[model samples]
Target chain A: MRMDLDKQLNGSVQKAFLLLEAFTLDKPEWGVSELARSLGANKSTIYRLLATLEKLGVLQQNRRSEKYRLGLKLFELGHRVSIHQAVVHCTHPVLEEVARAIAETVHLAILEGTHIRYLDKVESPQGLKISTEIGSLRPAHCTGLGKMLLACADSEQQQAVLDATPLFAQTANTIVSAAALRRELAEIRERSFALDREEYEIGLICVAVPIFNQQGDLVAGLSASGPANRFREEALPHYVSILKRGAEKIREGIGNFQL
Target chain B: MRMDLDKQLNGSVQKAFLLLEAFTLDKPEWGVSELARSLGANKSTIYRLLATLEKLGVLQQNRRSEKYRLGLKLFELGHRVSIHQAVVHCTHPVLEEVARAIAETVHLAILEGTHIRYLDKVESPQGLKISTEIGSLRPAHCTGLGKMLLACADSEQQQAVLDATPLFAQTANTIVSAAALRRELAEIRERSFALDREEYEIGLICVAVPIFNQQGDLVAGLSASGPANRFREEALPHYVSILKRGAEKIREGIGNFQL
Candidate 1:
């Protein structure tokens, strides 16, 4: 009986999370019937779980639509996350410093699957700056941060990720061929920096360097992004130097922390 | 059997959330045995739930400590939260504008029980700015944002909250007594703003105004904080005016959103 209860509990927990996962930026609201249909779940089961989640403030029901959305409780739990504390808070000031010096947007990101998840960012004071939201994920192949981190990734990881994700071209500059992408990664590894010249988005450019821990394992990527016009070739060396310095500071601050 | 399974699933979901809640900022990491003891539950049940959560990446086991902590999955879900998209993303720019214009740290907050949850913040550019973190909860009685939001709350809510929570003093100036706090809130309601003169922290001073949505319901509180020395008596009216202006902008942006 005890074993049965434990299995049931675990099952419920998994189901609840699966339900929460259905609510995304693309579709933030989910009515029980539609959600159950999408997940191939029983409608009554979905309804019961929704009620339980709502009771804990994990899911909130919209008054007008009668649909469930991810609630502020998750927002609260996110803040409690140690990764944000360990990585974001420790390296944010460095990102801010780099942003101020470069007068451009700065980002700290870690490789997550085939994407780079933005952990923290400091916006450029300029009227026009790259405005990617924090906690957002972007394609690794077409981003400076993604490439820098991916370059540092193990061979198995790189091959597996590349295999799983298509290198869709965002612009004329995006590396479309896998062989060419591998060559670019090799070059990035050799040089210890990656550049995105209108690769992800037109008129946007980025330069990134890997942030290593004291133990010499790559933990994150630090990057500065701005309008392609303002990112002069002459400033590439300068950008790399400042970003490397910021990376070192993060290395010191991060200590032996793991993401 | 369906009804039985539904009951078990709901039970498990609630238990899992309760277990998750045990991992807080103050005590982020937890061992299965310790957690079970704290929750006063069966060790086997807690162990199973922990394993399930760890499998889903909702919690991660620290390699050295062998304790579970909130993980990247929660951080990812936090971003997917609609409140963050509806409120923080919408008002963050305005908070930044106010911070830049006032040269003081700016915050947007909502009353949560006897506390105020910081939804978004823009730090002051100066070297000596307030250092409260986003998603942190602070005593509402002592903060400008808290007091302003609390002032606008319905009387029953105010009474229930005051009755439930002890008005603990943080500093000499903090409103320690419920009567004094009620009077202060009443005055804030009359003036349509709130002030904190070293009430929470010795050197910190703040001014805040309530932000109302399009339907004229108070949704949030917007505040600016600076050093007590810098916050002059003569500048009170100006601060109130700027805060009110900022609140008006939030009203324009936040249509009919509820926290």
Candidate 2:
């Protein structure tokens, strides 16, 4: 078939990209032998691919360890992409203000297919800061920001995303059943906000409100997160009100940019 | 030679990555026909590679315009790399403090190959703000941060880098000569700081001091930048002292992280 021929032709390029994707926050650097074993490819082939990548400046090897890592070229490309994202740029000042006022970690994220891509974040100067990195992706079924964005999807699109995504429980409080998630999403839509009371991670609480653009479509979610002890159930109303105000300010900013 | 055969084999993969690298801050999106003509490749080949990249989530197609742009997955990867960079993470607070105190834009950067990679940046809250994105790369021959970092490299390393890089004149004040650059680097080494008197950009002045790790190796550069008119010559000593103190704080933070 034509599809089969196309796959065969693109196989080498795909494999090369797979090597780049193998590096992660947890396992950033990789030795040739280890990468070869993990990828189930011949050592010589991996070496050639890595060498070609290094020559292109898409990968770099440590001078002392000889282990390879993602090169600075990717950073250059990604930063350009970030600068162009209106959702990220428009929310930077608002996120900073919200974090400063509330003294909590604030985030701006958008749903990318079945995951949430964090566009920007501002951490509290308070000593117990959370270690969430911008550009990190998280499952769409477990986090407050993810659910807020998901709740905005149309029924057909929501069904398609739900069907394609595996609803893996990230924590004990995570909603694992399709029926349960649908009900929760419906409630979130009715309430115009979403909450994660230790759903994604224990001892953490978060509340998020959907950010809308000029056309009033969901563009991103503005979230405020902190330790559960400080983020008490009694304070939910106050936090949600602040988040809604912040979301309005972000929407105005987005409108001002005509984005 | 073996190198010739390797290049031949890796030709398709190289083409695929070239497309990825083609996206930039100015030309963030490209149509298939435009890309094909630019790369001098067949339309079918470019389309196939773009499709593969889209499927891998490293590139995305605009729904309305149908132009291709870098995807969120690349942002995820790059953000992870930024989080892992001790120079970037450790200097965030210091950069914010410096920017707030001096009422100027603060930047932290490291040398990447022949260029300087901006790891982090904080803008002055005042009405006049400089536009510099993190993860952006600039020529080392023009920036004060770049010169400070180049000053730390040994003669052979400096010569190797200089040989590979073209001394493109970014501004009228830029140094374009190898001998002149060598002399400038020597002075920077002796002074323990570098100054950019509108070399990189007209009407902008910058001062940078080197940042070192626990092992005392040059790891990064901390810079304070502002409009030339506001950054007076007599106040240079005071600005330098504040930046040095901030750099020491960052050094302590990096030491605490055991990075």
Best by lDDT: 1
Stretches of model 1 off by over 4 angstroms after superposition: A1-9, A93-105, A122-133, A162-179, A197-205, A213-216, A224-258, B1-9, B93-106, B122-133, B138-143, B162-182, B196-206, B213-217, B224-258
What is candidate 2's lDDT per residue for A77-149, written digit by digit as tens? 6776733455676678788888887889999888876778788888877877776778877887889998888
Candidate 1 C-alpha lDDT tens digits along B1-259: 0112234348888888878888887899999889888888888889889999987879999899899999788898998888887898778778877887888888989988778989888788998867786777888888988889889998876886578545777999988778888889999999998999899999999999999999988888999999988878998898788888888998998899876
Q: What is the interface RMSD of each candidate, in Å?
A: 2.3, 2.6
Q: DockQ, per-model, please?
A: 0.54, 0.49
A17-128: candidate 1 lDDT, tens digit per residue? 8788788888999998998899887888898999899877898999999999997788888988888878886787788789999999999999988889898888899999
Reference contacts reproduced by model 2: 0.47
TM-scores computed on chain B for all candidates: 0.82, 0.88
Indicate the DockQ of the complex predicted as candidate 2: 0.49
Compare the candidates by DockQ and give the number of the best one: 1
Stretch of 10 with least lDDT, candidate 2 chain B: B1-10
Model 2 docking tier (incorrect/acceptable/medium/high) = acceptable
Choose the strongest candidate by TM-score. 2
